[model samples]
Target chain A: MNFSHIDLLSFKSSPSPQKPLTLAPWRKLLYIKQEYPDNYVDESFLENLQKNVNFQSFDYFALCRESTVITEHISSVLIFVAVFIQLYHDHLDPHLLVSLGSAFVFLGCIIWEWCLARPAPPMHKSFLKTAAVFFLTLLGLSPILRTLTQGISSDSIWAMSVCLFITNILFFDYSSDLTYSIQFPGSVALNAAVFACVLLASRLSTNLHAFGFMSFALEWFALFPIFRRYLKRIMPTGHLIQTLLLVAITFVLFWPISRAIAVLYMIAVFSLTFICPIWLIFIQRYKNEIHGPWDEARPKVHRFRSPQR
Target chain B: MPALNICLASDFFYPNTGGVEAHLYSLSQCLLRRGHKVIIITHAYGKRTGVRYLSDGLKVYYIPGLVIYNQATLPTVFGNFPIFRYIFIREQIQVIHGHGSLSPFCHEAILHARTMGLKACFTDHSLFGFADTGSIITNKMLKFTLSDIDHVICVSHTSKENTVLRAALNPLNVSAIPNAIVGSLLKPDPTAADPEWITIVVACRLVYRKGIDLLVAIIPRICHQYPRVKFIIGGDGPRRIDLEQMRESYVLQDRVELLGAVQAADIHKLLVRGNIFLNTSLTEAFCIGIVEAACCGLLVVTTKVGGVPEVLPEHIIKFAAPEEDDLVRAVSLAIETVHVRDQRPELDPFVLHETVKRMYSWMDVAVRTERVYYSIMKVEAPPLIERLRRYYGCGQWAGKLFCILAAIDFLLYLFLEWAFPRQNIEIAPRFDHKRYVEKAVWRH
Candidate 1:
């Protein structure tokens, strides 16, 4: 036996034979309206879509596939060049840079400890024990790191350092999690910087200079990401200023050819961000989600063996 | 009736044992029973290479290639094009039917077949999510592959909806064709021929998605209420550890048996041992297991998630929410219903036979598939325009793209004929005469 149902639509006004138009509540949202399988293109629909005063032409910018890799490499290259300039010019003492960086790292650590302490009153001793162990590990690792790459060449070391730094940036998850922080990037960045310093440490004339450079890298890469992330979350304006200041500082340090290249890179990066989102929106127009009774039904398992700990 | 040449393409083939493999096998046999020439194309498995026959005139070409993660061949679009072209031409393939979404092999087969000027049909057997990144990428890939296809076949109505949305295909181009079970494989176990002890069968990979977590929770409670009831759990996965923990905690050691990955040949025997076939899965499309269980003359107690409710009538199967408590209650009710009666209720054996006959059959699938092939082969604009009208409703952007792709594909077909003329290729003669005739008689 075949089972079928007939559907009837009740309207307040009588339908006309020619050029009859029946309009429902018109809204831009796609999901809410009664949908028909056969209604692909309504005759008056395009005309009404075109009539909207606010409708504007969408820009389709081409995305350079290698843009992300180029931007990351250029910025890191610029930062290293700036550090080298400071060291050669002797305007900023290597020892002094190292000391200041270490001080900042210590302060950041103290603040992190303070925040974590507030969550659990009885876990203060456990937190202190962890903090103590962390400090000790850093202290012990520094000496070993100083002599770690002594066997390797200066150029090879620099090359390795650059690769590791890039790897750290690429692998780091950039999802907008609740605990968004500069510190997250900063720590990995610092780790990469310290490895670079260790390679350059062998180039230093004295042990103290090597120690200073290593400390400087530790401070810059490790603590900076956390601070950056915290600042972005706590103060948006401050984060924007910091980003602008870094860009401006990078431009000034690079100068001449590098300066122009930096500006072009920034424009390219901004264009890339906008281009991707727009492309995604354009692609969304192709989203023909076909749902019916044929797809696998997700079972609703209600048995909770352990409802609570 | 003239026998039609049918080519079956899937990411999965023989030497592999799963629903898709069984589906391909049963379908080929069924189509052969209707006097259709069936050939299967699958990525080569270890030591299983070149063309081989599986019993009845059904030929399988185990095309040698790399098996990527989980038996799915490494998908290099256009890489499999040449070999596939050779196979299609050699076999005089009229209809190209691909199975499974995850198989790039299946997707590529459909695309190349379209480009080679053959009618292509895709059968989707699984459901996918739109929320995840992996699913998003897969969906986009599906759209690209499905852009120029003639028709799509899904196992259930829900699967049709999913494929339409996932690939952005026209709804009418898709059809709900549920999978079928071989009646001989499923029969109630004769050994545990007792009316007192109720045996509940749970067979599936013990995974999180399978709702094995809910199974672990409910089994103890079920065993508690009914002392005589015993559980036979089949298949194994990571969540088996948790099930073991639950088993130990509840101390229902002797009541439940973990068979652990029973072979395909043994599934029927394992299923027969149980009075109630329990499916605790949280989601499904058209569950072949439930149908097979029903075929075995066992009452089905399954969670009403996905397309399980639509698979069978309410009288034959008991429904429950995907939750643990509800499943426990539902199973209890099924057991209670079974006990109150002196003997098992007279379940219409014809229900399974009629359902399998009406909704499934390789000949029906092949005939419908052949129509799509004929439509693609026709050069005239009128029929092509009608097919385009069906595709033009997928989406605003997709409709235009699909139309353009289909038109371009048609042009490509004309070009390929000029480049590689069909007159140059030799067609192989039919495999057998007496057996083919005998098989057709057997089916009716």
Candidate 2:
């Protein structure tokens, strides 16, 4: 049996003008026999093919506006570091720093209260009570925290803090949705930041310094993020003002330490905030998402109809 | 054409029952009738191991391996190559055809066949989404396996389009060969229809993807709308509890019957008992069950999902959107057509049977598949460099990675050939085709 002969037979059996073979319309299936071959690709083969059907084109300016979340987070981390350096060098008095942090916490609470449309008295009372208890507990635990890493080497302490801080920065919830609750850096993120603060406080020489710094770190990591989130929701202009004020303060604090390092940091922060969104828009041109009838059908049930299992 | 030695490789086969397994078995049986020597290679299922022969003289070699979820072999890429190479040599196999995209054994066999310089073909039997993590990984693996494949076969046009996009293959290389049924076994029963009571039969795995949720939601409403309607659900899965609960809550034990896990042989008997077959599957590739239902002369009311719209003529099918209200409306309309104004929708079961028989048969699938084999065999095998060139266009980094893997696989093939020289392996005895021809003639 010759293979080429079978091929020729199949070809001859196909519909021709003289034979007047009836050709079925291509319904894109091989169940029904037709005049065409098995591999015949009709003109409408890819007629339903769609590319980037649901793609949303990004605007560079809007993207930049959205990226202020990252800028705010970076500035907050930098300010914490600047405060640590000032405390470590014994340049700023511990009492003054603690008083300043307490005043700001009070002011932020009032603003947070103002942001709510229907403020509940019990929630405000419970929040104040929780804050009072947290501060008192921190003051009592200062001596223990000050000596938490007394046996560890200074170099190891520094390395541990660096690792924890990096973990905190990496896992921070940066979603810009105002309704998204601030979960206190949530899970591993919060643990890592608290661990880093404890390590840094253990490096202080006295209990008062440890207590002041520990309280300030708690306010910065835990409380300030909630305030910033609500502040952004209630007043976008105030959020922008807050970001600018933080950036200027960070630059000034770093200036006293090293002018060159501060200048490079400012340049890096500005470029990241401005240029990254543009790069994202540039790469959006290459996104190719193909959808067709071949994809799975997502069933649309209008009402919540759960079976009584 | 001279009989060519062929091997059907997949993780799914006998000891396991599914659409793909049945397809492989039926196709191999038809190919055997055409005088081709065919053997199946699959991962062992429990006590079913080593070489075994079915009643039709079709040999299956079950290699021992780890079975993962859904009877798929764990994808140890290079682990199966040595044994595969040995079997290929002993059987003198010329073509390696693989079935099912999710079967790691099939993908591995295709990859190794390419390395050994043999013609390779793949059949995709499922549709996958592009948004999910599992699909993304599976599509990447499919791309690697199909990068240098000789030909690809899909069960439907939607499946073909899906495979083409998933593997980035040339459309010309892929053929849409639908799954077929043993049409002779599914004879329509003339006494099955009742004018007063309409029975809607659904025989599929009771899973969420099979639209058991929609079935659960619509059953009570359907029963409420038409008091005489009956439902016969003939499969069981994790969703059986939900269905049973629905049956109890609605107090519909008399109208709705649940036959848990019916056998494949009984499917026709169950389908023939109903006037309509309701399939509410959210996603399907070809849906052979609906074809079987149609063969039993039942009007199919199925959701308009992947490849279903192309399955049957419009006269016998009522398409429904995969929504509760739409399905309820469609089923109600179908019931009305069957009961009240039953003129335009009424179809003669004999005509439907003839149409279905002419449209699909395993013998047709085998003939079309043999054509694919011949077309692939006519082209000379390309050089290794040329094969690498084809694989190099997979992705930016994936291209180079695939090239390296292909090169390594080629080297491994050379090593295996050197270690277990093919000339030394004993050849398996081929089945006598004259006896099969005599038996076929006697049976017919």
Candidate 3:
């Protein structure tokens, strides 16, 4: 029955009519004696070889929606770069940056509550303790952090910053929605972003600027993905709105300094959200993932109760 | 037919014991009985280096090398050429037969054998997949290794299909040859099992692939349904702890007996004591364990996975999906069959032993294998250019790389020929079966 897929092979090598008719038909069983040669390719050969039995074709809309996650992530990273650029030019006040970061953090917390998703179980007592400790630590380390990479050439700092951001994007976990805390891959991405921010923070003229930038990095890199994944899972519409809001904010942030870059960024985001998903759907027809009896069996273990005695 | 001087090469052999090792030993023994000069070439195991003679004059050459993961030597693709060339020339090996797809040593041997202009045969012992990085690499390597081999052999028909797909081989060139089960070790003892209660035996490596999770699930349920039945779980692995935990959770200390990592020789003894044998392999190419259990007169209850249903008759074995409930149902069916079969002399353990012996014997495998060998022997080994042409068809990128590797192997062969010419290398004396049988060892 499994050999039904081997139609081409069986058609070509169907038992030769020239042979003695007394020979019994070839059977798949090994226990029985057969009169064919060892390498005899029976007409039924490979009938069992299945191709893409578990194939699931993707829908254009769903694919496009999935593509938004990438778009959203890219927008957030670009927004952080725009914010950093604004800070480096001293056009933006450090206190204003910190206030803006605090307002966004408060909004993220409000959204977490609005979803009535898994109650942030660890949020109650430790949230204030964590904020206090984080504030004190940054205050203590600001001078050292501000001067850490000051001696390094600007060329090296920029190159390293680019490398780390690429690493972050490559390793970031975008699918999983179970953990409030990010998984290992996501953690690697967060660490890369944090290190990149630290390298950029060293170029700041003062401790207050370094601390404000570091705080923004924490909110964006460390916590935003977990919140984004959660929002996408429980409320897809809200996730889409958040993505658009971030893209708009990034566009506005970059528009002040470079209108050309800001417009280009919008075009990239629009295509990433709209066109790539169509391309993905178009390419879905070419997907030929072969699955057969040869694939490793995935064990389904649970509190399985046998219905029979 | 003329006797062929065959060289069976694989990373897995004699010193390291498993399915492939046992297959190599038994098949070589049968080939030796047929008057073929068979020799085994594997990497050194511990201090077991150089040449050693197995029973029936089946010579083994353990070429000393660095042992790495899973007893397989380090994969230095062209590094093995010199020694393999030396062995091939000295032994006058007409056909190079490599076993096991996972063994880089075997793959390396096949590549170099073709480079030296020798007919090569490969026997795949396990089923593999197209997914996963490890399997992808393995499939690509197999495609390269099998690009121009004379013939290929698989342990089962499903395995044949799998190998053909994995390596893109012609269906006419690949043969289905099942591994032979030694008859002497599996003689059944009907009376050894107690009439008071049925004892179910599961003899497999307690690994996830062997479906230990299914065993863990069905054991308690089966015990609840059949109060008198006991279980004997043989073999050990990382999943052993899971089984132990299951037994503890169900408080089945009295009913379940864990015979951890039973020696291969003792497994048959364990099989004889059980009225039913349960196999829960998730994906199996060929299950020799079930046949052995049936030979010992145990009614077989196993998952209907890759090549398993083709192994035994419907009356002797019951099939189940890899799921828990179905496995439990199969066990129940098997238990009932065993109960009814107690009265019939035809289904007796002794009778089953004779039936299995007739159905699957090493002699049968050897005869079929000999036929394959003889067929391949007449074909001329292709020149390096023709060989490179075959490798180039493997893939756009991989083909060129394979061609380069084949050319390098050709250069290495020339260097070895110049460094250690055939005239300089002493040809080892052929094993005389007649003289060996006449003479007896008396070191004492």
lDDT of 2 by residue, B189-240 (tens): 9586555679999999988889988898899989988899999999989999
Task: Give one digit per residue, the lDDT tens place, for model 1 in B1-444.
Answer: 466788999879777777889889988887776667889999888888888888787888888778887688888765776678878998999788899998888987887786666777788888786656878777876887776676677776656667766786656566556677666446445465355688899888888768887787788778888999989898988888987887788777887888898898988888778788899877787788887777766778998866677677777789988777788889999889767544544554445434433434445444444444444444322356655664465568877876776666556556667787777777777788456557676654
Label model 2 with its docking quality class: acceptable
Candidate 3 local lDDT, B234-335, one digit each (tens) = 898899999898888788999999989887778877988899899999999998899888888778888888889889898778898888878888898877
- How does model 1 score on DockQ? 0.13
The digit string of per-residue lDDT tens for model 2 on A146-232 reads 998888898998899888888887888777443334464454666888898898888887889999999999889877876777677
The predicted structure with the larger DockQ, 1 or 2, is 2
**How large is the interface RMSD of each prediction?**
12.7, 5.3, 7.2
- Candidate 3, which segments miss by more than 4 Å at Cα? A1-19, A114-126, A303-309, B194-196, B440-444
- Residue B59 error for model 3, in Å? 1.2
Model 1 alpha-carbon miss at residue A60, Å: 26
Candidates ranked by DockQ: 3, 2, 1
